[model samples]
Target chain A: MQWSHNMRFFQSYAMKKQLWIIVVIIIAAILPTIIGAFWINVAVEILIMGLFAVSFNMIFGYMGQLSFGHAAFYGVGAYTVGLLMAKLSIPFSLSLIAAMLSAGAFALIIGYFCIRLTGIYFAILTLSFGQLIYYIVFEWYSFTGGDNGLQGIAAPHLLSSVTAYYYFTLVIVIAALIVMWYISRSPFGYTMRAIRDNANRTRFLGINVKRYMLINFVIAGAFAGLAGGLWGPFNQSISPDLLNWTESGIPVFMTVIGGSASFLGPMVGSIIYTFLNAFVTGFTQYWPLIIGIVIMLIILFSPGGIQGLIDKWYKHSDSSDENIEL
Target chain B: METGGRNSGSKSEREEITGESMDFSLIFSQFLSGLSRGAMLFLIASGLSLIFGVMNILNFAHAALWLVGAYLAYTFWNLLQPYGFSLWVSIPLAAVALSAIGWAIERVLIRRIYNRTLSEQLVFTFAMILVIDNLIKIIWGVQDKAIVRPSIVASPVFIFGAPLDSYFIFVIFTGAVVAIGLWWFLSKTKYGHIIKAAVFSREMVSALGIPVPKIYTWVFVLGIFLAGLAGGVQAPIGSITLGMDNAVIIQAFIVVVIGGFGSLLGTLVGSIIVGEIYAFSILFWPDGAMILIFVVAAIMLIIRPWGLFGTPMRT
Candidate 1:
């Protein structure tokens, strides 16, 4: 009788949580309509970067590896889309697929070399690979338009309108997030976590750690490419600078600042960083300095990030029920 | 085997060009340029290797310090020019300024993060790069600055029948002097042994009444000083631009990685190898010169991930 009561209580709590999620989703759906044009555009950027960060988190947070060159995949995706649309006049859907495939290929090649090394060495190799991609893209002047980049990327008629494009991006991001969430909860994710926690022990258990990491890397790259594909049409241009190591640092910053411990941490980081970028750049060209100082403070003072602070506050306020999961 | 073939190929090419029984003169010119390039790399990579050796921290901001060194040299040159000062005076002055800045960074920021994770250390130093890059813009403006060579060393000298720039010779000489000085300090001096011992076991050194933190601060300062000195010297050869820091830093990183981080002799050999490769590759494969560095480093990792001289970590 006690077990039945406990199950009923949990069901009710789960239903309530689902309801809350539905409400948040509805709010997000209608947000662009209520916001100004400028804010809506910013929202588009936030959504794209948020997706990128979430994908990045799969490796950094879930897999316990930091890839310092994630932007290379993102740039590859953008360039693939831009080139396909500008040169071959491929349809939007096909171009998007191509972008993901290309980025996935890139991740596979880079990760083959990278996954063998751990910690700082992995970070450096990824960084070097990222720079290599940037240099190639920068130097291939005829095809990539050199440093000028590709412009006038064509979008499908349905996505021609800014509002329509925004909604399209919103739907794609939400679907991607759902798929990502499912994957995280799957057996593969558990193995990933196992490897991350103790790779040697995981290896002793007869699991091929490197292969799993490579697959995760490919998945992460594909998602980043998807975001980059969206970005090319949104901006109507793409540059080699997109692949710069400094740009790679953005996802890292977002993951760390948003809290790398939780599922939603990188998304939160993306949102905060997007807003911070939009807000700070409006006032000063010294944005790098401000962003640098803010990140430093976050590292020094709030190592666990915003989510961590919230968890602490929740624990303090609700001592009777301290087992809340976020 | 392939490298051997490439070397002989280049030598034959040199022989054909010079049209001589002995192409020693032609080879000598290549050697001279390689030495100069390697020396500059050494100045930067040694510092990077030393810091990693001691603290296990890959200081990204070291590159920014190089930029600071260049800009400071520019500023000091302009100021001292009115008072009849030379490039020599300005270069050393810039080095001192950088040392101060490096010391401040260690004491105020890096000193607190000795026990933090590697990711945190990288990001924190990366943040410093952003701050310093922007600060350079705010202080020095966005324009590239050029420094004229000192009048005393403005002309080329005929060495081994090659007209090498006097400034290049000076740079080579400075690098050699520093290399010898560092060698003496590390291998022959008591302080050098202390630093090495500290790198091997920090706790044991501390337990033996050594102020490990103080030693670390000084070592970091020394690293900074080298970076600054490199920038000051390089400023005359190339214009100081916004992106120069990243350009040099990446190359220096490749040098350190190839040489094996935390090993002085490794750094020396790595720099020379890289420098020679860079010098010759420009002649044979101009378009892919930069890519060659990455390729070599990749091969090195494949063959020996711990680097040529670096000790592998115990997992």
Candidate 2:
């Protein structure tokens, strides 16, 4: 009787959580109708960049490796769609898959070299690879449009409206986020955290650390590419600047600001950063300076970020209550 | 970025004018150019190598200091334009200013995060880049600036039957002098030995009553000084633009990686290798030269994971 009661309570709790998630999704779906075009566009950007940040956190937060070349995969995904739609006149849905594939393939190659080292060396190598991609995109004028960038990219007529595109982006981004959430809870995620904590001990256990990391790298790239695929159509263009290390730095900054300790930390960070960027850039051109100061403060004062602060408060309250009870 | 094209265009035009005799001169001149390029890289990477050896932190914004130096040099040069020794007077001034800035950054920002993770250090410096870059833009505006080479070094001089720019030769000389001076300082001076000792075992050095943090500040300042010197010198040879921070820093990283992060001697050799590769690539494959650096670095990394001159790290 006691076991059955506990099971009923757990089932109800799970249902409530699912219901909340559904309600959130419904709100997100209707957001375009409620908001203006500018805000809806901002919303689309937030979702895409949010996915990018989450994918980046997989390597940084979960795998304990900060891969700085993330934007390279993101750019590759964007360019794949941009090129396919603009040059080959392919369907938008097919272009998205191709974007994921191309980005994943690129990640596999770069990750092979990058995974050989750890810590700062890995960061440098990934950054170098990213810059190489940017250089290619900038110099290869015939294919990439060089400095001018590729433009006029869009989805099919049915999804041509801004409202329709927002919904499309929302659905794809949510699906990707769900898959990422699943991966984080899976045994592979446990092994990742183990490797992060102690690679040698994990190696002693007969796990191929590098191979697992490479797999993680490839999956992260595929998801970043998905974000990029959405980005190309939404922005209606793609540029070499998308592959620049500055762009790569965005995810890093977001992850740190959002708190890398929790699974949803990067997603929360993405929302904050996107909104901050949208709002801040309107006030001053020295946004980078402001951003730098913000990041430095976060690193110094709240290394785990806003989510970390909340957790600390919750824990402190919980412990204090127990002490009072005692 | 147009710096690449302008430099290449002038080289090709000079080749067209020289015509048949261009081959021998081209090889010799390219070699000279390569050496000068390597020397500049050495100037930048030597400081980076020192900081990494002693602090074990790679300051990604080290390149931003170089940009700052270039801009300061531009300012000083313009202010002292009436003076006959404008370039001579301005370069050292820029280097000094940069050292002060570096000192503050090390004390105020870097000191706060000494106990944090490597990723935090990287993010800190990366943020520093954004801050510095914007500060530069705010002060200097978005336009690219260039200094006129001092009249003494502006003209080309005939050396080995090839006309080489005096400024280029001077850069090579400056690089060699700095390298030798650094070696002497490390090997001969008491403080230099302390710095080296600090790199080996900071806790032990600190336990022995040496102020380790002070040494770190001095080492960081010296690194920034070298970066400033490289930038000030290059201001005349190349355009000092808003994005030069990003452009040169990656090359500096390639130099450090090839030289082994903490090894000065390795930095010198790596700089030469990269410089020569860049020079030859300009002659043969201009469009792909930048990509080639990453490719070579990747290959070197895979073959010798610690780098050519780097010792294996335990982590």
Which is the leading candidate under TM-score? 2
Q: How many backbone clashes can be found in candidate 1?
A: 0
* Separate DockQ for every predicted complex: 0.46, 0.62
lDDT of 2 at A277: 87
Residue pairs in clash, model 1: none
CAPRI verdict (incorrect, acceptable, medium, high) for model 1: acceptable
Cand. 1: chain B TM-score: 0.90
List all candidate RMSDs to the true structure: 5.4, 5.5
lDDT of 2 by residue, B1-315 (tens): 332243445565645545756677678888988999999999998999899889988889999999899999999999999998999888889999899999998989988988899999999989999999999999999999988876788777644335778799889998999999999999899999998888777889999999888898999999999988987887888788897878778888888888787888889999999998888899899898888887888777667756787787623
lDDT per model vs. reference? 0.84, 0.86
Docking quality tier of candidate 2? medium
Name model 1 segments beyond 4 Å from true.
A1-24, A317-326, B1-30, B158-163
Decoy 2 TM-score against native: 0.92
Candidate 1 residue lDDT tens string, B1-315: 232233345555644544553356556767788889999999989998899888888898888888899899999998887665557899999999999999998999989878888888888888889899999999999998988776767776545444467688888988898899999999899999998887687889899999989999999999999988988888788788996887778778888878887889889999998888877777777756677777787677656777898878611
TM-score of chain B of each: 0.90, 0.91
